[model samples]
Target: MSTVPPLNGSWLLRGRDGSLSAYAPRDEAVWCRAERHPGLPWAPPRRIGGDQRLHAQLALGQGADGYAHLVAWRPTVPGESGLVHSTHFRPHLAALDWVPIGHPDRKGDRTGLPAVAVDAEGRAHVFARNKGGGVGMLAQKERGGWGPWRDIGGPGAHEELAAVTGGSGRVELYATTSDGILRWRQEEPGATLVPDEALEASVRPGTLTALPTSKEHTTLFFADLEGMLHAWRPGTDPVPLLLAAGPGRVSALRCTIDDHDCTLLAQRSASGRAVFAACPTEQESAGLWWSESGPQLPVGTRVALAEDAEGRVVAATLSPDGELRVARQKDEPGLALGAWQSV
Candidate 1:
């Protein structure tokens, strides 16, 4: 039988360059870097941090800070710990230097999933789950510096997918909770976060994403732990849709509205292979849910999918054969994007 590695972690990025990098922790006390690019296939995974075994959410893109950040969590005590993300890249020292965000309840405990989101204003909002007191902080990037975390709402991290998006109308913050989906407009005065139970009723998931597909509209998509992909209109509930079958795991996703219909792209692994499942159907159970696979990408690849300014489906997958694959057409001319050399 082919040995299958445990699927417990995930990675995300923003760009489609030949060389794209993301972070994951293989062993305790260390985090490793996985990269992909063109020309040379990627090398094997390598350790990138000295004292981080757990990674909340790793992103390989310039944040609102306009700087690349790689943040991870490390074990502190028993149930308590903290996270650190890079605000500045240290070229001379080798690995990027980092600054700690905060510690857990019990001195050094493992606080699950410390996610950081940087808005267009360069404000880095770092959140974590189970920080005790059912409370999470919303820290502002004051003077482009970290620290001074202020309290927001909710108990602990609530694990909401928080983000900021703008159109011709205004910029708004979007998130999902047990109460359903909620919104808070930044541009509007006295903007209060309110629940959209109708929208929430549509969202039968734990993950969501909001991306601008046109010059004036934004859409959100999600896939709970289950491999189902759903889309939410700007002010509507999630229209659940089936995307794939088999014991497939969705690694990455993106949603962008095109004209009247919305498009969702997700990276999924099934039957020991990696494939991109892009749906054009506005209905939940519509479209072919197309996927591509070959003999080479057996270890499966991590898919980082996104939509361009034009709203076309663009996918980036790091193949088992070390190729950094990108494709616009689900049925494309090549099998992989480009070969990446390992370091």
Candidate 2:
């Protein structure tokens, strides 16, 4: 059995079982079921009212109240789907309570997968692309109610959003348009969201990730279609690191290790092997080094990376054969990784 470990003091890993039902790992091998449909025998056999099949994509964030919030989308039929939200109150608990939020959508709208981030006030902000290719947002109010979905105004078709919270009352959203334009929006507590013009980065038209290093600074990372890895800050030009080109999707996370700012990136090679790299400084002079090889992953496998409170970075991936595997970095400032282990 493979397992997914929660990072950054988080206690839950939201994913789907072999049956496509929502579940959270109770341990390395045991999964606590999240589906509520009693009709589905493979899903813990509960009576919760909602769609049973959860889309493979998930967004997780820790709220100000010390609880972790998860959001996922489920397809209802050929042309409609709905968003599901769940909360984990206690770390030791095995199950989570899930509820539906926002309105259902028709299939043609091509609304991309949703992304979430928790504000300083403990409210959860959700962003997604509308059918018309504009970005839309929904936020949790201070009193525990969900605000109406409103347009944040960015022109992009099939774009994915990534969010990071900085300082006390600031949240930043990043996305790439179909035409390869990078745009961002800044929201301060109760202020309006006015996005800046498209940025001048040679990025491909795909998902991008963002990490906030300070109140006014954030680092963005993305892989071009040719498999070249790139990183960019707000005012500086993008820095490309020397790494092997592969078709694997790129994922990144920023954490402080041994008092040094470390950024970790993971992707799969063309041979279905996992590769990892670490950069300890703002400049690319340190260069990129590959970690020890792991077991072969399925082609086009998706990977997720997170850092724990101890500054250890953990990576999780679902193999093409439906097995979930995990691995961790050995120490700080070194690109070495432990052998991949199944749950």
Per-residue accuracy of model 1 over 177-205 as CA lDDT, tens digit each: 55555554444322322322234343443
Against the unseen true structure, what C-alpha lDDT does each candidate score?
Answer: 0.45, 0.58
Q: In lDDT terms, how accurate is model 2? A: 0.58
Residues 139-201, candidate 2, lDDT per residue (tens digit)?
A: 888788787878777766345566666544466777775455545555458443567645655
Give the top-scoring candidate (lDDT). 2
Q: Kindly report which residue pairs in candidate 2 clash with one another.
A: 36-48, 79-107
Off by over 4 Å in 1: 1-19, 29-61, 64-66, 88-95, 104-108, 132-135, 155-179, 182-198, 202-205, 215-217, 224-228, 245-264, 279-288, 296-301, 306-343
Q: In TM-score terms, which candidate is top?
A: 2
Weakest 10 consecutive residues of candidate 2 by summed lDDT? 6-15
RMSD of each: 6.1, 7.3
TM-score of 2: 0.76
Q: Looking at model 1, report the run of 10 residues with the lowest lDDT sum.
A: 189-198
